[model samples]
Target chain A: MSIIIKSSDDILPSEITDQKVFEGRREFIKKIGFGSAALLTGGHISLSHAKTAAGKYSDLPKSAFSAADKLTDFSDVSGYNNFYEFGTSKYDPAQKAKSFNSDPWSVAIEGEVEKPGVFNLEDFIKPYALEERIYRFRCVEGWSMVIPWVGFPLADMIKQFKPTSKAKYVEFVTLYDTKRMPGQVLKVLPWPYTEGLRIDEAMNPLTLMAVGLYGNDLPNQNGAPIRLVVPWKYGFKSIKSIVKIRFTEHQPLSTWNKIGPKEYGFYSNVNPQVDHPRWSQKTERKIGEPFWAPKHDTQIFNGYAEQVAHLYAGMDLKKNF
Target chain B: MDTVINSNKYSSSLYNPALIKPAVFILCLLPLMNLVWNGFNQGLGVNPAETIIRTLGDWALYILLFTLAVTPLRKIAGLTALIRVRRMLGLIMFFYASLHLLAYVWFDQYFDWNEIVKDIIKRPFITLGFATFILLIPLVLTSTNKMMKRLKRRWKTLHQMIYPISLMAVVHYFWMTRADFRQPVIIAIILSGLLAYRLFVYFKKQQSI
Candidate 1:
C-alpha cells in the first residue's frame, strides 16, 4: 500500500503540539510508515538526555555499544520481570501492570531545583538525542536480559538540573495511583516504591535514563514512561514508572531495603560473589538458553567495572550491599 | 458446569439407575481431561512434573476427604443408597494418589534414590506426602470384597488408618506453601473442619451406645 507520510521537520513544535494532529499520531489508529523520509525526520540511532543541543556526544568516538557484533535476541523476555510492588514474583510486574498507563505521563523534577515543574513526555522526548547502548540487565532473581537502551546517560540528564551541595542523593519515586497502577492497590507492598543512589553513583557516565529499549519504545510491562537505568547495580535499582526525581540531603529509605533490609541493601550493587540469603547469586540463568545448559557466572559490576568500579574504590561493598 | 463436565444426556428419573452411574463417571473425568490437555501442551509451560504431581496429589487428598465425607454426607443428605459408590471412589482416590507420588519420584527427582531418601528425611512436607502415599497401599490392597470378608472384624479397624493418612495429606499441603496460601490453606481448613465433625460424631455415637 502506498502511504503518504507527514514530514516531522516541516511541522513546527507548536503545530505538532496542537491537539488533533499530535493526538491522531499518538492514537495511531492507522499504521505508521517508517520509510527513508521518516528516517530523515531526525530519528537518530545513537545517545542523548532529551537535550535541545544535539550532536554533543556524536563528536566523541562511540566505543561502548559499537563493540556489539549483533543485536541481542531472546527466546523470551517474558520470564524476566522486576515488579516489587506485586510481592517480588518474577511474573508480578506483567500480571499486575494492567492499570499502568503511559498515555498521560508527566515527570516532576522537584526538591532543590529552581525549575521544579512537571515535564510532559510527549514534548520532553522529542528534542532529545536518542542513542542505543546494548547493556546486560541482571535481575535479582538470577535471570538476565541483554537490552539495547535508547537514551542519554544519567550524568548528562542530571547535569541539566545543576544540583547544589545539598544534592547528596538522587531519589526516584514511582507514580503511585491505584487507578493507574493496580499493583498499588495490593497492600502487600509499601506504597510509592522508592530507590536511591549516591549523587556520585547517579553522576557516573554509565548510568542512563531509559527512554526506549530493544530498539523500540519500552512495553508497559518493562516500565514505559521514564525510568532510571543503572547498569552496574541490581535490576531493581533501575526504578520503573518513575514520576519524581528528587535531590535530597538525607538518604531516603528504598522500598526493597525497607521491606527486607537483610535481603536488599541500599547500595544493592551487582556482586555475584555475595549470595542472597535465600538463593545463590554466584551465577544466573541466561534466558533463551536450554534448560540443562549451565548458568553463566555473574560479574561483580555487571562487567562495567572499568566505567563505574572506581567510584566506590575506598568503600566496602559487603557492608554497603 | 455439569454440561461441561459430562455430556451423557438423559432425563433424571427415580427409576433410572444405570444412567446416573456413568454420568457421574464422566463428570469425574473433567478434571482428568483438563490434566490430559495440559499435559499435552508440555504441562502448560509450568514445571510439568511439579504441576502434575501437585494437581493429582491435591485431588487425591480432596477425593479422600470426599470419601470420608460419604458417611457424613449420607447422614446429612440422608441418602443411604449413596453408600455403595463410596468404596469405588475411595479406591480411585488411592489410584490417583499413587500416580501423584510416582510422578514426584520418577520425573521430578528422576528416581535418584539417594535424593529421594534425603528429601523424605529432610523436608517435613515431603515426609508427610510420602507417608500419606505409603498408608494408601494397605487401603488399596484391602479394597476388594474378598479382603473385606477375609478380614471382616479387623477390616473396619484397619480402614480407620485413612483418618491419619488424610491428616498427613493436609499437613503436607499446608507445610509446603510458604506464602500466598490461597489454595492450600483453604484445603487445610476444610479438611480440619471435616475431621473435627467426624470426632464430634464419634464421641456422640459412643455416648449414645
Candidate 2:
C-alpha cells in the first residue's frame, strides 16, 4: 500500500532518530511510575504537533523549486484535476475517477531502450531513491498549483534502463479503457492520452516520475499509482496514469498537439510571451488563492529557466510553444 | 380559441405581479445568493473563481433564452400580464451577463486592460462574447417604457438583435469549452428551436396577410 519507497538509503537513520527522540523520551518517562493517562494524552498531543512542525515529509530533502506560498489545502489539490478520461470539468475527475483501477498497473517501456518490455509499477521504481519535490504545475489554461510530489528524478529511471542512441524523444501514454474512463464517450481527445518530451528534457534533473503527493499515495484524481511531473512545461506535458513509455528517434504524436495543432504545441513550455490561441498565458491565477489575490506572472520554462533553458538554447520558444 | 379564452380569464386572477414579481425577483437572485453562500462556506470547490464564472455564465444564458421565450409563451398561455415581467427578466439577464464579464475582467484578467484587449482581439470566443455584450447595451438601455415609446417602430426592429445575440452567446459558450460539449450542444439546439419557432410564426402571418 505504501507507494513511496521508504528505504534506509533514501531515509537516513538521523531522520528516524529526529522523529522518535522526543516521543521516545516521553514513552520512557511514562513507563517510570510518575506517568498517568492525562499526562500521557498531553504528551501524545504534542508529538502530533511536532510531526507537522517538522514538515510533512521530514525525511525527504526539500526541492529547490518549492514555492514560497503555503501548500494548497489537500482538499483543493485532490478535488481539482483535469483528467479528461474521467470527465471534462475540474470537479468531474475527482468525482468520477473512482472507477479507474490503477492497482496492479505496469508500464511498457519499448522502442529504442536497451531493456524494453513490460515492467511492474513497483519494480520499475525500486532501484532509484524516492524524494519529495514541490513543483509548480502550470496548466495550458492559465491556472496553476504548487504540488508536493514524491518521486525520483526521471533521468535516474531512464539511465537504469539505458536508452539507445536512437532515443531522441521519450513518449508517454495514459491508460485507455472506456469502461473505466467514461469521458472517452466524447471525442474531446484521442483515446489513451499521449504526451512527449525531448530526451534531454526527459533527462533533466527536475523531471520527476511522481507516485505520491501531499505526503500520501497519489489520489486517483491526481494521476494515481504513477505519473510524470515536468515542472518546466505546461501540465498537459505531464501526462497521468501512464501505461506506456516509448523512446524514438522521431518526435511522438502528442495528444493535445494532434487535437489542436495550433493551440497546443508539442513543446508546450510555459512562456508568457507566446499566447495560446484562445487565452493569454502571461499570468496565472493560483488555485485556492482568494479572488483579490494578484495573479502571478508566468515564467519562461515555468521558473525552471536556469535548469532547463539550456536544452532549448537556440530553438525559438515562440514557435515551439 | 376556447382554451385561450379560458386561460385568459384564469390568467387575470392567477398572474398577479404583486405576488409574482417579488417571487421572480427572489428566484432570479438565487444563483448569486448561492454563489455568495458558497464563497463564505468554502463550498465553491478548489477553483472558486472558475466555479463562479461558469455558474454566472450559465445563469446569464438561461435567463437570456428564458426572456426570449416570453412572447411565444405569453401567446400560448394567454397570460397577458407575462408581458409586464418580460422587461424585468431581460434586465436581470443582462445583470447576470455583466457579472459574468466582471468575473473574467477582475478575477481572470485582474483589471489588465491591455491583456484583456489583446485577448478580445486575438481570441474568437472572447471576441464573440464581447460583441454580444456590446450589442446588448442598446437593448438594455432602451428597455424602459419611455425609450420604447420614443423609438416606436424602430424600437421593435432594434430589439430583434436579441435573436443574433442569443446565437452569439451560445457560440461563445461552445468555443470556451474544450471537451464534453454536451451543455453547449444542448443550448445550441434550444436556441435553434426558438429561432425556428419565430420563423414558422412569421411565415404563417405572411400567408394569412
Candidate 3:
C-alpha cells in the first residue's frame, strides 16, 4: 500500500520564466562567478571565523537539558556575579575581575581516582564536545537567572579519571592566589573556596563542567576557563575558577557551609520549602525582570526534581538544607 | 556662658538658615532624584528592585547618622546654626525609611500580607527593622513645632528614643549582612562616637550641678 501524504498543488509550466531571461541570467551569473564565489566563500569564512574569534566553544549545540525559559540578558549574566575571589558585592566581581588572569591554567585531579594527574585546561576539555545548557540558576540570596552555559557533562569527565570504589564524593577547589584573587587577603569564609558533591551527584548527567556562557568565553568574574555547574543546587554550590578536583570517601567541607553550618548546608540543593536562616527561599526575583515584577515561586530542586528528586529519596531536605 | 553666646553670634553671622536650609534640602533629595531618574532610564543595573531597596535603606541610614551628628557637630564646631537643619534632616531620614519599607513590602514581598507577617515574626533582622520603623513613627509625628510645644518636657524623653532607634537600625543592618562586616563596623563606630559624645556632655552637666 502506498502512503498518500496531503500536498499543496504544484506550479504550472505556464508560470515558468522565459528561456531568453533564464539563459541571460545564467550568462550574467557566469560573468560574475569569480567575484560572487569569493564573496560567498569569504562570507562563509568570516561567519565561522567570528565564532572562533569570540571563543572556542561559541558555536556549541544546545543540549536537551537546557531550560526553555527566556535567557537572562548577557550583560546581566556577566555583570552581576558573586565570585568572592574578586569581591563580596555582586557588582564588585565585574569591576575587580578585569585584571584577573586565567590564562595557562591547570586543574589537578587527585584523590581516589586511578589516574590522578594535573592537566592543562585545554587538554582537560579537548575530549568532549561542548553544549549549551540554558539552566535556571538560583542564588541562596533569593535571586535567580536562566544562563546559557556551554560545557559537557561532568559525568563524562569523571569517567576518564576512573574513580575507585572508595570514591563516595567529589571535591572541587577554586584558585587561591592571594595576589591574583585580592579578596583572599581578607579572612572571608577561609581562603581557597572549596565545594563538594556526592559521587552520584557529581556523576549525574545534569552536572556540567562549564567553560563558557552566552556564546562567549566565560567572563573572568563568571569563573573563567572552567567551573562546575550543578543545576539542582544553589549558585554557591557551582564553584568557580576551579584549579583542583579530588574524589573523596567523605563529604568534603564547603566554604559557606564551614562559615555558617546552621545556615549553608553541604547539600545546598534549591528547595523552596527549606528557608535560609536569614532569608526565605520560597520565592526568587529573576535578575532582569522589572522592579515591579512579582518574584517567581522557587521550585524544589529548581524544577530539576524530575531528574534529581530520587537522589534525595528518603532524606529530609529541610534538615539537610 | 559668654563663650556660648559668642559662638552663637559667630555661627548666626556666617551660616544663615535661609541659604543653608534649601541647600541641605536639595542635598538630601539628590539621592532620591538620582534613584527616580535611574528607574526611568534603566540605570539601576541588573537587579533594579534590589538597587532601589538598598539605595533607599542606605540613604535612610546615612541621613539618620547625619541627623545624629548634627548635635555633636554644632557643639564641637561652634556652628550653633547647624541645628536649624536637624529637624529637616530627621524628617528626610524618616521619609527614606518609609520608602525603604514600602519597596520591601511592594517589590520584594508583592504586598503578600501572609509572607510579610511571617518575615516579621520569623526573621530577627526584619523584626528589629520593623520595630525600629515603628519607634520612628511617634518621633516623626511629634516632630512638629506644635507637638513639641504641646508635649513640652515629655517630648525630650520621647525623642530620646532616637538613640536606641539608631542602635537598633545598625544592628538590623549587621544581622542582614552575610559577611564582610566592614560597612556595618564603620557605621557602628560613628554611631558609638555620637552616643559617647552625648554621654560625656550629660555627665559633665551632672558633675557641674
Q: What is the per-candidate TM-score for chain B?
A: 0.85, 0.92, 0.92
Q: DockQ of each model against the real complex? A: 0.08, 0.63, 0.69
**Candidate 1: pairs in clash:** A46-A131, A47-A131, A48-A152
Cα lDDT of model 1 by residue, A186-215, tens digit: 565678979899999998877888776644
How would the candidate models be sorted by TM-score, starting from the highest? 3, 2, 1
Instruction: Write model 2 residue lDDT over A77-123, tens digit each, in one string.
Output: 78888898888888898889886788799999999989998989889
Q: Give the best candidate by lDDT.
A: 3
Q: What is the TM-score of chain A in candidate 1?
A: 0.76
Q: Candidate 1: deviation at residue B58, Å?
A: 7.0
lDDT, candidate 3, B50-150, per-residue tens: 89998999999999999999999898987666788999999999999999999999999999999999999999999999999999999999999999999
lDDT of 1 by residue, B1-209 (tens): 45333333323544233444565456555666898897666443323444576678877877877788878777887644457567877877877888887777775555558757866876677887888888888988998999999999899999988888888888787776533456776887877777888899899999999
- Two-chain DockQ for model 2: 0.63
Kindly list the per-residue Cα lDDT of model 2 for residues B52-93, writing each as its tens digit.
Answer: 889999999999888878887888776655676788899999
What is the descending DockQ order? 3, 2, 1
Binned by DockQ into CAPRI classes (incorrect, acceptable, medium, high), candidate 3 is medium
Give the lDDT of residue B120 in candidate 3. 96
Error of 3 at B2 (Å): 18
Stretches of model 2 off by over 4 angstroms after superposition: A1-58, A64-69, B1-18
